[model samples]
Target: MRSIWNGAVSFGLISIPIKLVNATENHSVAFRQIHIEDGSRIRHRKVCEVEDREVTTAEIGRAYEDADGTMIPITDEDLASLPIPTARTIEIVAFVPAYRIDPLQMDAAYYLAANGVPAAKPYTLLREALRRSHKVAVAKFALRGRERLGMLRVVDDVIVMHGLLWPDEIRAPDGVAPEAGVTVRSKELDLADVLMETLGEVDLADLHDDYREAVEELVAAKASGGEAPSAPVADRTGRKVIDLMSALENSVRQARVARGEAGSADVGADADADVKPLRRTAARKRSEAASEPPPSRKKPARKTAAKTTAAGGAAKKTATKTVAKKAASEAKKSAPRRRASA
Candidate 1:
């Protein structure tokens, strides 16, 4: 790959000549502006306001606009005269733990390649030192026209540099979090933990850009003069969830189903409600009563009485399991009742 910048890394008295190349690339579909009526391509022209005519790149110059709306012309010669030591060198200012660098300050990333055969020793040495120390080098370098802060760390066998915004550039997250009045229940937190565990970790390499793929497919269909491909519409029930506990429980079950752990049972009729959230509402009590088997009126025969005893034992066992599952929910609701009584 072609390098964007050529510079030497200044580490104390040692200097390693290196080339900087971008670490990431954009792969997105581009669209051009066109005249809808004439089906003609649209192009923009640059014109000077004073001259009122089109201008070439050679005629253009850089300028700084003041807050008072005055334009100050800045020539290339004027910038070149500036005394900046980091103009062509990546100067290592300090070494710091990787966690010390705020993620919010992270910007563009680049790989530092050894510029020449002689520079390989120092490059490898720096990479090994950074790896053994478990730290990153804070650096200052000039690229394009401005000086930037960077973090140097080892990625595999290569030394990579990540551009970072200055601490002052990061905005304070004032009024960004949720209101203080909102509260999360312990039951809700438990359900959220289960949901997290169900989803678990994912391999980033296994993921792909679905939107980009869809756009590419659309473009291909248009180019071939064929009807655009259709995708199956997702079933979206326009339901607004009012209960946080119910939502979290449902989310966990859905995540488990998506991971294909419970086979088809999760989406089937006989799926177990082992982790069901129990709410102490009037509607819930009514629903629980409705689900229970009603009492039989007729007296039982001797043989039937034995069967009835066995059924009673089984019912007691099931009730015990239910109580155990609802223990936390019951404790939470009973606390208020006890307080009221006291």
Candidate 2:
């Protein structure tokens, strides 16, 4: 994995030089905007709001706007001069039990690798300590001009850091979650328990992304033959949701069928139909041949150059003839004066 950032894990006085790499990546297939009828790719441009025209990077600048609508243009120099220490030291503030750090507070995950041989020993020491103690080090660091809180823990025999949200950043769930006074039947709870027990502990890797797989299959099937597949219509007949007890019972039955404990669940007519994954840099280099006007096919040839030289020759000849005519006229007038003197 390519290291995105290079820094040190400040374990007290010892700095374990390490490089940070992203822990995860999105594998979902992405689709771009395309015209349906023509299959033409639609390109987007960065247009200036005020100018109402497309603008290039050279025309753009970063700015900070005030509450009063005042925009202060900022530069790279300004960002570099921010008060973050140049050392890029990730300070281990404290070690607390891993359970103390809420998963909701975690933002992004990154893996840290020792930069060199010297840092390896200290890095291993910290990793082992955290592993034995069942604790995660709370780290404080600055990245991209912002102070960040992170939890450092040992994962897969390597040190991983989860970027954390500040206390104020984590919003209160006061009004979001429904109040727990809703009556749930004991029977429903039993069914839920059965479903959970049946499923047991699932390895995340064992699960298949059915939607994505179906989408890919549909695309492949369509592409194989020129025939465009018919779109699958969603079941939106406005069916009323069944009672909670019935729903729980139905879910448990389905789960049992999926696990092969019971008979197969009823399949619809379009059950086998592939559902195409519904997930939806190149500088536009002007193709010289296409973008430019085809080289003037009627280019002035070498014959044109010869014509120009001939035209110059003709002009020179005309000048010589005029000079000769002037000289003859002077000679004729001088001859008459010479005859009168004789």
Candidate 3:
């Protein structure tokens, strides 16, 4: 909580004494250069080219280098005597909407603390004013011998100042975007929307740096004389998609599966699984129709009637043949009896 700078915020006629402290810190792992062959620590010393000797910190000073390779030495007294109010004060230029500040212009952040009891009232007043107006105060302050633009806004009960780069410092994004001839289809956008929704809004606090954690683990393992843990490698098929429509369909299904939706299979596992839901539904309907028996038609009914008539005629002819055979057998028996009588 050490203050880097002690300055006063000039708000109209009100001067609020505040202490500037960095709002963020670097947690990344630091590495030192070493001699690989000797396993010894490597050191770099600040040496002057003209003298060809190492110099102490007190001997070093600031200078501006010109295009002609000439160094123009600048003294501390010269910088302090500069005719600018921002040299020792944060002078508010104007109050503007916070959205007017471009994110690309944002740099380091700091929290402004009221220096003493006398500054508390004015500090709180400015904080409340900024909160009520829903705007930020654009200010100019000198830090590290250079004046920088800053946007002042209220964070909770504290007044936070975010360092902003000058408009001229930002480069125009001319060739950063894709060429004009390329385009995106509505279908692709729909899939992208689904993917975004599937990922959803995440709490930033729940996230952490995986690489940093791994590095820490590796260092711990080395210190303990233990085997370093190996991270699992993902198995990628590296298959190039030939059909965008199918790819989008599979992506939607995969997203649904990831969101814990029921009856969703991992279509990414099967190369042939790239099927649209609408097309699948239509195919299912067609298969169901094919499986069911056909309906009774008028032509089928007429054919059945004709078949019944032919069956009746065949039965009558069979009956007539049977009666004629019986009459012939009786005549044969009578003739045999007459022969016996004679």
Candidate 4:
């Protein structure tokens, strides 16, 4: 990782030499605009409306419009003469409870690492102190020609500085009217809870970028002599929305059936197909044993011999036995298992 800024973090008379490294990285694929006809790259030009033509970089000037609608041009020297203070250091002003800050105020995060010289003692002290107090240090620093407000907190034994939004930047919840006189049935709420329970454990690793996968698949298909796929058609059925209570009940029923908690007619059909041959073969063996004289008690091995013959007669007998035993054990445990949905 490259350091975005290099400066010291100051508090009182103590200053720690540190460098700021960006904590987040984006893996998104990038593309540029091109001429569709000839597949030629496209470029943007800087044009001046006053001159009605493209202008060079050096010929451009910065100006601000005043209340009187007059454009006032400012030079680099004039901007430098302004009373704005430039402090490159991250100065901690005060410590506040971390929970008091809204998550939406957080803009960017950067890791602070000590430059060359060991900062182990001070770093550890600051990190442990913040962790114990559950507070974050509000700090100010200069970056990209402007002073910014930031929060300094310890995460995973390292100090990180996160940029914050100004108070005015946060939008107020005004005009967001609440639902009045709306009633919810108790049974509907209970059914919603049951549906949530049927969803088993969440594994973030299982989530993937389906769009990227689809793009790759399309590319492969095109390479294999297939035409490029068309864009997806939007769903415009215009069907009426179902009642919330009924929807919740149906969702609960579906979840239960998916988790094998409730057996459906389809499940019964599958179960019957799986056990039909086993039942028929077992009955036939029993009938044959009954036709023959009952094995004498002196030969107890006859029972074992009958069982072995019955097992061998079934197709994939060993595999079926193993699978049946495993299923039985899993059913006895009664814990929910997550399976990928088709």
Candidate no. 1 TM-score: 0.77
Give the runs in model 4 whose Cα sits over 4 Å from its true position: 48-63, 68-86, 216-225, 229-241, 256-342
Write down the RMSD of all candidates, one decimal each.
19.6, 34.3, 17.2, 27.2
The superposed Cα distance between candidate 4 and the true structure at residue 255, in angstroms, equals 3.9
Candidate 2 lDDT tens digits, 74-102: 99788767776533889988999988988
Candidate 4, 1-342: lDDT as tens digits: 789888778866777778899999866556689999998999899998888899999998888899998999987666656564335578888999988889989988999988765666666777788899899999888776567889999989899999998878999988687767877654445556556767777789989887777787777787798887777896635323356655555555556677787666634342112211112234445555565876678566888888888877775777889999999999866655433231
In candidate 4, how many Å is residue 258 off?
5.5
| Candidate 2 Cα deviation (angstroms), residue 201 | 2.5
lDDT of 3 by residue, 121-193 (tens): 9999999999999999999999998999999999889999999999999999999999889876554555566
Ranking by lDDT: 1, 3, 2, 4
Find the 10 residues in a row with the least total lDDT in model 1: 269-278
TM-score of every candidate relative to the true structure = 0.77, 0.67, 0.77, 0.63
Lowest-scoring 10 consecutive residues by lDDT in candidate 2? 276-285
lDDT of 1 by residue, 59-129 (tens): 99999999998999999888877899898899999999999999999999999999999999999999999
The residue pairs in collision within model 3 are none
lDDT (Cα) of model 2: 0.78
